[model samples]
Target: MTPHATYPATQFRIARPTHQLDAVVAFYTEGLGLPLLYRFEAHAGYRGAMIGLPGVGHHLEFTEHDDGAPCPAPSKDNLLVLYFPGRQELDVISRRLEDHGVRPVAPENPYWEKKGLTFEDPDGWRVVLFEGSFGGGGRST
Candidate 1:
């Protein structure tokens, strides 16, 4: 069966504002292991980055003011759940995050059933590193 492409987005971007852009970038790139797909400085007094693994069809982007002004507080309920292919990969990711001084947190919602480790970003937004998922195909962005 063919899936109808109603949305024009082949690439989906989730954007947020950060008070600590460097730390946030480090968390995604160094800690979470997402590749730094690109970085840009906008004339609108903010710069940002796009991060994701290759060929994922979707990525995360964030912007921050050069003045380091605080944005609105991040919601604890918002989450970015990333799925790795295997348990070993999850282990590796866990270690990387730990090396970056991140401690795992129990998710606000417990439906994950301990299948993954959850870490909060510098902005207090949550990201779940789970073991196994349908990796990036056959869906609209």
Candidate 2:
């Protein structure tokens, strides 16, 4: 199997410091419908949140320092691509996002619109929700 087709890490952690902890957490939990796996309550004056779907091998973590800046402005080019099983699942997620006041947006990349809808999170990060991979187990393209 190709390297991208294979599962390399047992557990993957992507840590990024965010100034908007509450807004960012709400975006993931409400807009994306991700579960809050766990939390660190200002661990050593650093607050953070980890979010991901169940049975996934990795999680997206957001952090902020208590003594750091009060507000965080996410980069424009920061993009996260997520794949859903089918249109049915995508529609359900869309409804969830709408309920949370997140509407579909046109991405800078035209391919995303052709594949699926996109949304800009509270922190200004982009989220592309597209169709799932043919071979499904854990990680996907």
Candidate 3:
């Protein structure tokens, strides 16, 4: 769908503040294997990184203010769910995450426990690597 036809925006960004900027960037970039699209330092006393697949119309922005950015995750249930085509695709990424010292955790929701692997990032935010299309006729939980 066109940007104007959707939410009146051309792109989408999920922005969050964290004290562990370096670790957070590494988790998404190195562990998850997402490309770092952009990075900035000392911009109005904030340093940040944007990471996601290029040309995907959406990306994640993580920022840290010079003063202090101790934004802890509010809940274990809040997650960033990434749906892969199948287990093979998800396993490939899972291996990389494991190689980087990331491990899957039991999801707070039992539905996810049956659907995919859930991992907590450095900032205590959860990420679920689901092995199916999100809105397609993949599998029921």
lDDT, each prediction: 0.83, 0.81, 0.89
In candidate 2, position 102 carries an lDDT of: 91
Q: Which pairs of residues collide in candidate 3? A: none
* Candidate 1 residue runs with Cα over 4 Å from true position: 1-6, 67-70, 134-141
What is the per-residue lDDT of model 1 for residues 1-141, given as tens digits with 9 covering 90 to 100? 345467566777888788888899999999988899999987589898989878888889888887776677767668888887787999898999999999998888776545788899998999988876843594211
Model 3: residues >4 Å from true position, as ranges? 1-6, 136-141
> Per-residue lDDT tens digits of candidate 2, residues 59-96?
99989898875555656556788888788888888888
Residue 60 deviation, candidate 3, in Å?
A: 0.3
Give the candidate order by descending lDDT: 3, 1, 2
Checking candidate 1 for backbone clashes, the offending pairs are none
Give the top-scoring candidate (lDDT): 3
TM of each candidate vs. truth: 0.84, 0.82, 0.90
Off by over 4 Å in 2: 1-8, 69-76, 134-141
Over the stretch 48-97, how does candidate 3's per-residue lDDT look in tens digits?
99999867999999999999976856598999999888889999989999
Give the range where candidate 2 is weakest over 10 consecutive residues by summed lDDT. Answer: 132-141
Which structure is stronger by TM-score: 1 or 2?
1
Q: After superposition, how far is residue 113 of candidate 1 from its true place, in Å?
A: 3.7
**For candidate 3, which ten residues in a row score worst on lDDT?**
132-141
Q: Order the candidates by TM-score, highest first.
A: 3, 1, 2
